[model samples]
Target: MVRGIRGAITVINNEEQEIIKATERLIKEIIILNQVAPENVAHIIITVTEDLNATFPAKALRSFEGWTYVPVMCSREIPVPKSLPKCIRVMLTVNTSSAQADIKHVYLEDAIHLRPDLQLTDRHL
Candidate 1:
């Protein structure tokens, strides 16, 4: 069955390097935690806060081997008041045998506050 893995990370700044590095880190962590293979990934959708316009998060994935062929899209997140700043989020649609409750969702840096209930412990991954 196809499952969706969610991940988000907060960037310190809107700099291109910062955005790229944070995005790569978030994606890598999600992949590692979920044991997601590129072949099993149907597509990825990334969103960034309005404050983050330095670069598209999907651009960072292109640098990884085997990710070039993966379908990726980037967009701006809904600008809610008092929302987290400089945040980048991703939803990876992947084919996995695991049940929905068994999937690992990654929330890094300050983004961890966004999903306290679903947040992972150190040993979870």
Candidate 2:
């Protein structure tokens, strides 16, 4: 079976360093919570607000301890009025047999408020 993990993080600013840090933190947490293997990760699609194009969030994964070849891409999130600013969201598709109830979804920092029903696991950052 295949499962999808969704997560998001808020950037303190539009700075490259902040985006990279936040993105790395979110991806690491998602991977850990799901016990995801690099090979099992089909691909990761990420979206950032238009205000955040200075850096690609996928680069953060490249700097991860043992993840250097994971396929990652970035795009602009749908712009809407009164939406969260400096937000980067990711949808990860991975091969797994686990049921939805056994899967973990992460919403960090301000993003936590996005999914109040999902319990948070320990954060890697």
Candidate 3:
């Protein structure tokens, strides 16, 4: 079966390096928590808040070792009024046997406010 693992993070600015670094950090946390392998991944869908267009978060996954072949996409989030700003969200689709409820979704930095019901601990970083 395939599952979608979601993760989000907030960056300090819209700069390329910061966006890339923050996104990579978010992906790493998801992989670590869920024990995801690149070979099992189908595709990654990344969306950034409308304010964060200075860079594509998918670039971080490309630079990620062993992720070169994994399909990834980037888009802008619906610009809803009062929505979180400078946030990057990722939906990782992977071939996994784990049940949907068992999948680990990550929220880091200020993005934690997006899903307090999930009860995720603060990221070590």
Candidate 3 C-alpha lDDT tens digits along 1-125: 99999989999888999999999899998998888999999999999998898888899987788988999999999999999999999999999989999998998889989998775665544
The CA lDDT of each predicted structure is 0.91, 0.86, 0.90
Candidate 3 Cα outliers beyond 4 Å, as residue runs? 122-125
In the range 1-125, model 1's lDDT, one tens digit per residue, is 99999989998889998999888988988888888989999999999999999888788897889887899999999999999998999999999999999998999889999998998777342
Return the clash pairs for model 2, or none.
none
Superior candidate under TM-score, 1 versus 3: 1
Q: Count the backbone clashes (under 3 Å) in each candidate.
A: 0, 0, 0
Better of 2 and 3 by TM-score: 3
Error of 1 at 92 (Å): 0.2
Better of 1 and 2 by lDDT: 1
Off by over 4 Å in 1: 123-125
Please provide TM-scores, in order, for all candidate models, with all chains considered together: 0.95, 0.92, 0.94
The root-mean-square deviation over C-alpha atoms between each candidate and the true structure, in angstroms, is: 1.5, 1.5, 1.3
